[model samples]
Target: MSKMYLELAKRNLQRAKVRSLLAVIGILIGVMAVSAIGIFGESLKAAVLQNFEDVANELIVSPNFQEGYKYLDEKDISRIKKLPNVAEAIPIKSDSLLVESKKKKSYAVVYAMDEKDVEDMFKAEKGSIRLKSSCVVGKRLAEFADIRVNSKITIAGREFRVAAILEDTGARFDINPNSAIILSPEDFEKVSDVGYTMLIVKAESLEKVDDVKKEIEEKINSRDEKVVVFDLKIILERINEAFSQINTFLMAIASVSLLVAGVSILNIMLMSTIERTKEIGIMRAIGAYRSTILRIFLMEALILGLIGSAIGSVLSIAGGYAIDLMILQDASYVFRLSTLLYISLGFSIGVMVSVLSGLYPAWKASRLEPIEALRYE
Candidate 1:
């Protein structure tokens, strides 16, 4: 009996091919918009988070110039190291100097730190960090200056060997190592007398980052706000929260299309009900129940929804991949579980809207008086 009703529903939809096709197209656009937008947002967030993954457990402490502090000193470094949950406090001195390599000259940011700290913070893409009379150059600096390992470079009139080239560290708040040079403290003093500029503190563990930051703020800024503690973990959390809100806003905007599709479904179902009135009257007069009539009409809507949502969900993968490539320069996030969940959400919403839109039309068709329906033109 259910099979017979489904067959009837299918046949009825086939009778008005153009109307059915329009309805399906409407649903397809709606679902594709929602799912593709969702996937794009997730991919963007994932790309941003990946850049911060390695540095999230670290904190950057620099002097607050507004408080009359010029630079972070040995005292500040000492205070930070003594704080609870602090693993390592690396003092950094930075200055800009003219660099000459292979007859090419450029100004590059120079950092002065211990060899151990350099080993802990950065990895060499080309050579090792010895930092005796030699220095490590960032990848960008090496490329721009045309310097390589064992190559002699002149910095501030003092000659030094380029011992290593650091790997590119993309988008960092603490230090941009990709366009700078690192030298030992003894070598740094030969060119500039600038004191420590900042301290990079590593927390004992990820969970202890907040505690370490708070302790540094309280202890170091006890008299006045001498230094500012920047917790990368907190920044990461805020970034994730911001992306989540943006994703919700984007999904809401996309849902407007689905609402329009729902209205189209309602109009199509109502017109279908009116056109099939006499046919329904005959069936009712013979033996069909109101519930049976209702199910048949709903089955039509269900079929339309299923067909549209399935196609939309499949197409959304390609849509999402294109969006990710254009914006993030990568499309790997489209296959993530979180992205697929969004596609499923769009599919479910499409089917639900279709069924809901058909409810009133199906009810009206079921309640029609057989005599009146039969007399209608």
Candidate 2:
């Protein structure tokens, strides 16, 4: 009996193929938008977290004073390095500047830090990191500017030799090395002021990271120039929280289209109810139970939702890949396990919205009296 009702529901949809197709297209667009945005957001966050994975056991300290802000100077660096469980405290001076090659000019992040620390964070893809008036360019930056070892690039009107090309590391905590130019402290001071942006302190062991972080904060707080401390763990947590809020906001915006699709489903179902009133009257007169009538109408709705969601799920994969390629510029960032979950979720939500929208039409169809329905023109 259930199979008979299912067959009737499918036949009803086939009778008005154009209307069914329009409804499916609406839900498909809604699900595609939602799943695409979700995949992009998750991929971006994954890239960021992956960049920070190397420095997970380190803490970053920078001045947070309101009026008289002081940079993390030699004394502060020394103080941090001397603390128990502390291994290395490296000061990094970073800024955004325009760099130009013979090809073109592009804005890039410039990092001037200790040569040894730079070597620890990045490796040379082409040449060696020699301490001089030379700089190392990241893989993407080098590719973009057509730079290589022995190439001369201009930074703030000063020309410097490209000593090495660093391997790509994706997006890091605050900067992307793949899009940055790096310099030693000697070369950095020649172009810009002698002030460190932040200090990266490595704890002796992973277990001592918390202990070293607490001690560093205490030391910085006791000084007149207070500084903020952020361990990599804390930074990851904050990044996750921030992205969660952003993802939720974007998903909400995408859901507006789904709501529109729901309205489309509602209108179609109501039209279907009106068209089938006489058929319903015949069924009622033939001793079909009211519950059976309700179930049949509801089954029609479920069928519509199921078909729409299935098509939407397949379209979302192509849509997600296109978005990643256009926005992230990284083809390697395809669908992950989390992406599959997002697709499944979008399909489920689309089906639920469709079924809910059909409820009123189903109820109205079920409540029609046989005499009144049959008397209709």
Candidate 3:
């Protein structure tokens, strides 16, 4: 009986082929808009997150210059190492110094850290990190100064060999080594007597970053707020939250298209009811129940929704890929599970809106008086 009604509904839709096609196209556009926008947002978020993965579990502790503290001391490092969840607390001394390489002079930001800390914190692109009486050059510095491994450079009139060339690490809050130089503590003292400038604390795990940061703040800044601890996890959370709000805003804008599609379906269903009124009256006169008339009209709506949504789902894949590539320069995130869920969400919404739009029309048709409809021209 249900199959017979669906067949009849299909036949009824064929009566106004152009109108049905328009309704289907409306739904297709709506679904495509919602799914594609969602996928694009997800891909953009993924791309942004890749840059922070390396530093997420690290914390930067810098002296509060507002409190008159010029630099971090050995006491601060000792206090931080005793804190819970801290894996390693490495002190760093930084200053700008004149460097001469191949007679081309330029000022570069110089860092002084323990040899072991340098090995752990940075990766060598070409040579090994051996900071004895040697220094490691950043990728940009190496290229600008025309220096390579074992090349001698003068730092404040003191000569030192380039031990390694560090890989380019993009912009970072803790340290940007891409345009700087790193040297051992002994070499730094010979050039300048400045103390440690900051400390980079590595947490035992990603989940413990907050705990480590909190402990450091409570202990180090308990009295006078002498130092500030920067939690990268908090920064990451704020970034994720920002992206989430953006995604929601985009999805809301896209949803307006679906609502417009729903309105189109409603208009189409209403028109269908008006055209079939006489036929409906004849069916009523032939002992057809009101519920039967409602079912037939509803089945028409269901069929249209299924066809439109199915096509939209298939097309959304291409749409998502295009959006990802255009916006993020990467299409890999489009295939993620989160992105696919957006497509399913769009398809479900299309079907639900179509059936709901048909409700009032089906009800009106079912409620028409058999005798009055039959007498109408």
Q: Number of the top candidate by TM-score?
A: 3
Stretches of model 3 off by over 4 angstroms after superposition: 1-5, 286-291
Off by over 4 Å in 2: 48-57, 62-88, 91-115, 124-126, 131-198, 203-211, 218-228, 232-242
Which of the two, 1 or 3, has more lDDT? 1
Per lDDT, the best of the predicted structures is: 1
Q: Residues 22-125, candidate 3, lDDT per residue (tens digit)? A: 88988898889988998898888888988898788999999899989998878878999988899888889999999999957999999998898877778999
lDDT of 1 at 219: 87
Clash number by candidate, in order: 0, 0, 0
lDDT of each: 0.91, 0.83, 0.90
Prediction RMSDs, each to the true structure: 3.2, 6.3, 2.5
Candidate 2, residues 1-377, lDDT tens digits: the string is 99999998889989999998888888888888888788788887887677777787788888775736667756877888899998888788888887999997988889887788778888888899765788989998899889989989998778999999988776665446788888888888777775888888888877799999889878867756467787877787898999978987888899899899899989999999899899999999899888888888788778877887888888888887888788888745555898888889889988998889888998898899999889876
The lDDT ranking, best first, is: 1, 3, 2
lDDT of 2 at 359: 89
* Candidate numbers sorted by TM-score from highest down: 3, 1, 2
Backbone clash pairs in model 1 (N, Cα, C under 3 Å; residues 3+ apart or in different chains), count: 0
What's the TM-score of each model vs. the native? 0.84, 0.70, 0.90
**Model 2's lDDT to the true fold?**
0.83
Give the per-residue lDDT of model 1 (tens digit) for 254-350: 9899888889989999999899999989988998899989999999999999998989888888899999999888899998999789999999999
